[model samples]
Each structure stands twice: as structure tokens, then as C-alpha cells.
Target: MPRKLLILIADGMGDYPAQELDGRTPLQAARTPNMDAAAAQGTVGTCRTIPSGMPAGSDIANMAIMGYAPKRYHTGRGPIEAAAQGLDCAPSDLIYRLNLCTVSELSPSGLMLDHSGGHIQNEEALNLLQVLRTELDTDQVQIIPGFQYRHLLKHTDGVGTLEAGLDLVPPHDILNTPLAPALEVYARSPLLDSMIHRAHSILTSAWNQTQANAIWPWGQGPPLALPSFAHTFGLRGAVISAVDLIKGLGRAAGMDVLDVPGATGLVDTNYQGKVQAALNFLEHGDFVFVHLEGPDECGHAGDLDCKIQAIERFDEHIVGPVMLDLARMEGAVCMACDHLTPVGVRTHTTEPVPFCFLDSRQIQSGAHEGFSEAAAAAGDVHLEAGHLLLPYLLDRMQEADG
Candidate 1:
């Protein structure tokens, strides 16, 4: 049997802000004993959230993290999300992941939701999606379920000409500059508006039915695909995430989603469950990807204290457990993030993210600190993230077998 290789991915995990508000960087404040311990026992390097000169989103950044070049691996967004929903797609189908979001009709908003869908619970999101499904009578339209705060819809009959892209303006004022200008132009699509209206109707009906007020879905339309880890490594992979886009990304890459409960795309997530699920895949010589969405969420939310708590919880609950599990396994362990989401500066940043690897073998640690950004910058392993880790893993596995 091939060795069991475990990988832990902290999505949007690279940003450890320097002296932002509380004087201590987020990572420095975070109680990441497991991660810090792993670094002490292994290799530490400086890696980017994605490669230099690319737009950072889970869609593309994940591809790079998982060993695929975005240019070659991107298939479009819809098909990717479909995979996590246990839906299949052909290469030609223009699939997009739909975020059932709540957008404010107020000043200077980019039509994006704070939560994937206003932090709506699955029961609520699912119910509203069901209503939207019923309302959409178009022959080409298809509605698919995304775990929580997300849904998958597609124009099956190939509406390539009229397809409104999912990269619409967000409802976030913080992310205003990029999305607003684009949403301003694209929101005019009658097809997009039709979906939004139906979603609105379902939300209204839902509010009436449940007697609970919630933010309605705002962003509609499909996204194009990016390359997945599966296509690149020639190894089957599974990525479990609370975020629809991450699952959508796994789907786009031709992977399956492990059903996890209470998987809100928040920091207070079930990290242990994810660790176990990834270890479960050891029976097959494949990769297991587990994504945590919180640190970034807190970062974007500008709640530094919350971000610290999440990271500490991750270290205590998730990272520590994963390290222990991988220690028992035969293959080496790899860890990294999708991008740097800084506290109080929630958007993706270009700064170098820290990566550490652990296994039974000896690793070359070149003067990098065992934790945080400043510490990581001091170490010897500073370079492009995607280019190094994947190939290095392939080489390591090959060498072990040899």
C-alpha cells in the first residue's frame, strides 16, 4: 500500500497582520501550538496564497495549491461546484456556482453578501433554493443543492451567448472597487435579474412561512471553471469545505464532497470532523483536502480578536489532531493555504503565506521562525507556494517508494 499522505489547508490563512490594531499580528496572537510544533519538527517555507500575478479566489488559488496550473486546469466555476453537490458535468457545459446571498439595496454596495448567503443556515438556504427551483421554469435552468450558504444552477441548453458570469459585483462595500464597476454593467442582464427575482420571491415566501426575517439572495449567474488538483497530480483527491465555492472548486476538479454537519462557513467550524474525514481516505492512495474558512472570515470582518480565537481553536482542535493522525500514517504531510486574508483587511493580499511540512523524515529548516509571518520570513524556505510544494511532494513520494 502507498503511504497515507495527509494535507491540511487553511483557506485564506497567510495574512498575519503586523501591528494593525492590537499590536500583535493575528498569527502571533493565535494559539497554534500544533502548527507551531509541526514547524519545529519539520520544514518551514514562505509561500504565496497563489502564484504571483493572478487574481486570488478559491477558484484559481485552490487549483494552484492542489498542483494544477490555473491557466490549464480551470474548467469554469459551475462544473466545479456541481461536483461537490454530487452532480456531474461535461467539458462543454458552462457551469457556475451560485451564492444565494443577501445584498443591501443601499448606498455603494457591490451586490455581494457578507456570508456566502448572509450566513443562512442550510434548512433556510435549502428551503429558499427549493422555492427558486420551482419558480425557474426555463428548459435549460437547473438548480442543485450546495451544503450551506450556497447553491448550484446551470443553463443546460448552452446559453453561452447570454450567460451572465458569477464574477458579478459583490454586495460588500469593502470589496467595492472591483465588483461594483463590473456588477453595474452586468446586473442589466434580464436572465440574471429573473433568477434574482425568483430567488427574492422564494426568500419572501420563506420569510412568510418561517416568520423569520433574513437577507435575501443577491448574487446570481454562473462562473467559468479553473483547473483542479485531480487533473494535475494524476491522483484522485477529495476537498471538504464549508464554503460552497470551495466545494464547487472540488467539483470542478472532478472530486467528491464529504458530507459534514454544522459546516457553517465560519471560524467556529468542525475542524476535528474534517481531520477524521481526510484520514479516512487513507485506504486509497489519494489526497484529502480540508479547508477552514474562519480566520479569513474574521479577517474580512475586521474582528482580530475573533480571528485569534479561531486560529487557536484550529491549533487545539484541528491541526494538532491532523498532525497526530499523519504521524501514524506512512506518507509525508503537506500544509498550506489558498491566500493571505489579513485581519481588518479581509481581502486577499499578495504577501507571502507560510507553509510547513511534517513527516518522519528529516526536513531542511533554513532559519525561518516556527510560527507567524515575521517568523516565517526569517526562515530559508521563501519562494512561490504552488511551484514548490506539489512537485516536492511528488518527488518525496517517489523517493520513498524508490
Candidate 2:
């Protein structure tokens, strides 16, 4: 029988040493008995998910973790989410990830108060998006609503007026910073700049809520295409994630994208539902990729206590239950983070993230005490190419059979 594969991704769980934690990272400081046990029983190592010179965003990192080389397959964050929404686009059309964010003002000197608009709920965000769609939906531009504060802007660009070199920065990277630099970049495309200003006016004057007053568009690209997961790995695969970017990648790769109710990409997400969905998918699927976004969200907020709680909850709610279920099966399991979203920096870094792989049929004792950056670095295994991680786990399963 072919061995099964389970890959659990705790998004942005890795971190740099925090002064608040007495020089220990959030992972090291968190209470993660399940992760610690896995590291102690399996092989722990580090993998660099983001390619050199690429932006350290979740889109690139998760793509690398899903066994695709981001340098070759990545287009932009927007196109991936577009795939999640099942949007059709012409080759020349542009798609951007539009965020309903909180800006102190509309001027260049304004500050980005909250990238997620105070973690706006789905209903409120949808209402705001609908208003924008009604007013701003032109022949060339369309407003697409997504979960929470995440949304999309599809530009047909039929006239080819937008420059190919137009670049915009992600809102999350500029938290609590002056938005002038990003606004300057936005000015590169007059259409986009004007739409953003108009969106601000519409959102603030129309809605009583001051949380999400502006629309920030960035991460533009054409539609993305990927090789089928079954064709590449010879296994039926599924992906469970609340984030559209991950779901979009799964859709583009022809993998099953499982959606669990109440699985918000936040600390209050439904953790038990995700585990149940993963287990259900594994009943017939040969591979299942489960991703949790709580830790990453906390990291982006720079909330140390919440980040630690998110990591602990991940271990208790997601990792512990799934590991117990897979223990009786003939398969291998891997737990890892895509990239380091250090609370100190409050942004993603292109650092090698720690990972642990275990073969249920032939488990081996590992030298590490737990799963953390320092401990994984001290171990013997390291993958300079993150895309090779899936293959490495499969190879280990094959070796166990031999």
C-alpha cells in the first residue's frame, strides 16, 4: 500500500528572539507539548521557503511549501487569490489584492493604522465592498469581495494604459508607518491612485464605521497556472485553509480545496473543524495540506501574548488531534511554518523555518528537545530548497518500507 502524507502548516509560526520572552522566540516560549513531542520523536530541520530576491509574503512561502518552486511558478499574491475566487481573466488583464485598511489620512503623510481594518468581520467587509462595487465598478475595473478585510481589484486594462512596471507595497508591511512612500508608488498608476482615493471617500462618508476607511491595492499579476498536484506527486491531494491565497493555489494546482465553517484566518478560528476536515479528506486522499493562519495574524499585529496563545492553541487543537489520528495509519506527517513573521519586525522575513517530519511506520528518536529555530538548526537535516520538503518526506516513507 502507498503511504499517506499529512503536512500541517502553522503560518508564520517561526520568529526571531523576543526581548519580552527573555531572548527566546515565540515558538520557543510557547507551551507546545504536541510539537515538542513530534520533534523529539521525529526529524527536525530548517527549510528556506522564500527564494532569494523575492518578497517574503505568505503567497510565495506557501507555494514553496506546497511543493512548487515560487521562483518559477509565482506571479503575484493577487492572481493566486483570484484563482481562489474562480475569476476568469485575459492574459493582459491585471488582478490586485485590495485590502480594506485603516489609514490615518488620505495624504502622502498619512499613517497605516491597521492593515486588517481592526480585523473587520465578513458581513461588515462585504457591505463596504458592495458599496465600492456599486460606485466604482467601471468597464475596466471591478471590485471583488473576499473574507474579512481582504478583497480584490480586477483591472481589464483593455487599453493597455497601465504600465507593466507599476509596483505597490503590501499594507501589512507598513503597519504604524507613514503611508507616503506607498502612496508615491501608487501614483505610478493614475487609475489605481484615483480609485484608491475615491474608495476612501466612499467608505468613510457612506459607512459609520471608521475601522475600514480606505482601500489599498497591491500585489498585481496576471492569472496564475500550475501543474496538477496529482501529476507531479502521484497522489490525490487536498488543501484546508481559510486564507484565499492558499485556497487559490490549491485550485490552480487542481487540488481539492476544503473549506471549514467558522475557519476564520484569526485566533478565534475554528481549529477543531480544520482538523476534522483534514481527517475526512485523508480518508480517500493520499495527501492533505492543513494551514492555520492564527499565528501569522498575531505576528502581523505584533501582539506577543496573542502570538504565543495562537501557537499553543495550534499545538493543542490542530496538531495533537491530527497526530493522534494519523498514528494508527501507515503514513508520514510533517509540521512546519512557511516563514518567520517576527513580532519585533512585524513583517515576514526570508529566513529558513523549522520543520519536523515523522514516519509512523518507523519513528526514530530525534536529538532536539522541541520544535524551534535554534533547536532545528542544531539538528542534522536542512533543506536549502523548501520545495524539496515534500519529496524528502515521501522518500523517508519509501525508505521505511524498504
Candidate 3:
């Protein structure tokens, strides 16, 4: 029988111990009976998905998760998001991930009050984007909107000299920090920075403005291309994610890039729809990558309660249902996070995250009580390279037969 593969990724699900929770991480505090069952029956261990020295961004870790070495195939987040937006730019063109940020004031010296602008809704984001395009976009620059506050800033006729090593800070990384320094650093790109300032001025004057008051641009880079997942693994695959970064990665890897309705990439995202999409895709495809962003978002907001609730919801709505269906399959299932978004720093951390692996016919034992960071740390399996774990997962059935 041909073996199937299901990889479920709860983005930024891992975390460090918190004092408020009596030194327990959100995953540890959450009641995840379904994941605990898998841990009890299968193998649980920690996998260092974020390569050493990497920024611990979703773009890097997810590429590694999809079996591409970050050192070789990884590019900046901008290009990946461009791919997700279906934008084809020349090699010399520069792309940056744009966020509709809320600031204390419209000036460059304003503080970054909220990176997500209160998680601005799509309709309002589109309205702001359209206004920016009309007021600020020029022959040299354009703004393309994604879900909520996430968007893209493309330098159509860039001078091709924008180095990837510019010191622009991710807005989310600088919450409550003064934006002047970052703005000054990014302003080195004369044309791009001018457009940014212009957009901010226009945004501040808008009559129907949301909390989103400025455009923050970072994650700049040139174009990127990657080998197809099917060509590399010899199996048809699909990726289901609400975020453009993951969708672009999947598309670049030649995967189906399945879309589910109501996938807002938020705590309120349609968990059931995503699981159903994965299950429906598995009927015809040999591999499926299902990614959830709720936990990550809650982590970024530093809302511990919401993060715990998100994890529990993920287990009940997604994990429990999928595991029940996959039990009858003649394949393997792997559940893991791409990286850790620690609540303390409200940013991604480079620490190794836990992973749970279960083979339908060849279950293991001795896993800890559940699938949390501590449990996985106590287990036996450890994958040094996140990308290499994919083959180890896919070949489990073959290993069982042998």
C-alpha cells in the first residue's frame, strides 16, 4: 500500500516556561487530550527547526519544515510574500513586507504603538491600501495588500543596489520602541523611504482611518526560486495556510497551496475548515502540510490566556479530528511547530521546539505525558536539522516494513 503523510504545524506553538503559570509554558497549561494520546502511543521529541543564527522567522523555519535547507534555498520574506501575491518582478526589483502599523504620531520619531494596528480587518486594510496606492505609489513603488495588516511594498524600478543586509527592523520586533532609528536606517533607500513618509502623511489625514496610521516596511530582498516538492520527494503535496509567507513557500515548492474559507491567520480563524481542507486534499495527494497561525499571533500580542486558549482550540478542533481520521490510514503523522514565539519577548526564539510523530501501524512508547516542550525534551529522538526530519517522517512506513 502507498503510504500517506500528514504534517500539522501549529505555528509558534512552542514557548519558554512562564512564572505566572508556575513555570509552565502555554502548551503545558493547555488541556490537549488528543495530542497527549498521540504522545502516549507514538514518538515525541524536540527538533531544532530554526537553524542556528537564523532570525527565527516563519519564512526560514517553514522552508526548513518543507525539506529545504535554509542555508541553500532560503531567501528573504519579501520575495516569498511576493510569490504569494502572484507578483512577478525582475531579478533587479526589490520587495519588502509592509505592515499597516499604528504609531503614536505620524512622524518618523513616533513610537510603534501596535505592529498589527489592532489586527486590522481585510476590508479596512484594502481601503487603506487603495488610498496609499493612489496618494503615494509611483512608477518606482507599489503597495499590494494581503490579509489584515500584512501587505507588500514592491520597488518596481529599483536601482538593484538595495542590499539584503539593511538594518531595517521588523515592526513587530520594535513594539513600544521609537521608530526614528529604524526609519533613518530604511531611509537610506531614498526612493523607497520617500514613498513611506508620503504614505504615512496621507494615512494620518484619512477620514475613515483605523488604528493603522503608518506603513512599516522591512524583509527586503531580491527574487527567489526553489525546486518543486514533488520533484524532490516524489509525492504530490499541498500546503494549507492563511498567511502569504507560507502560501508563497508552498507555491515556490510547487505544492497545491490549498485555501480554506475563513482562514484569517488569527485566533478567530476557521480551524474546522482548515482540517477539512487537509483531509479533502489527502484523498488525492500523498502529502499535506497544514499550518495554523493562531498561537503565534496570541504570543506576539503577549496575551498568555489567549495563547493557551488557542493551543487548546487547535488540539480540539484540528488535531483531534485529523488524528481520528488518520488512524485508519496506512501512513504516518507528524505534529510540530516551525519555531518558538516566546511570550516574554513577544518575538520568535531560536530554541528547539517539540515534535510528535505517530505511525499508524508502528506506534512507539515511553513518550512523556503530553506533547509540550518539556515532554519532547525528555524523549529520545532529536533532529538537529529541521529539513532532514521530513525524510525521516516520510520513510517511517518503509522502515517499519523493512
Candidates in order, TM-scores: namely 0.81, 0.97, 0.96
Question: 2 or 3: which has the higher lDDT?
Answer: 2
**Positional deviation of 38 in candidate 2, in angstroms?**
0.7
Question: What are the per-residue Cα lDDT tens digits for candidate 2 across 226-298?
Answer: 9999999898999999999999999999999998999988888899999888888888889999999999999
User: Of the pair 1 and 3, which is ahead by TM-score?
Assistant: 3
Candidate 1 stretches with Cα past 4 Å from truth are: 16-22, 88-92, 106-113, 162-167, 170-182, 201-237, 244-257, 283-286, 363-368, 385-388, 396-402
What candidate 2 gets wrong by more than 4 Å, as runs, is 158-163
Residue pairs that clash (backbone atoms under 3 angstroms), model 2: none
Clashes of each: 27, 0, 0
Cα lDDT tens digits for candidate 1, 354-385: 77777655444533445776666776677676
- Candidate 1 weakest ten by summed lDDT: 211-220
- Models ranked on lDDT: 2, 3, 1
Name every residue pair that clashes in candidate 3: none
Which numbered prediction scores highest in TM-score against the true structure?
2
Pitting candidate 1 against candidate 3, the one with the higher lDDT is: 3
Per-model lDDT: 0.62, 0.88, 0.85
Q: What TM-score would you give candidate 1 relative to the actual structure?
A: 0.81
Q: State model 3's lDDT.
A: 0.85
Q: How many steric overlaps does candidate 3 have?
A: 0
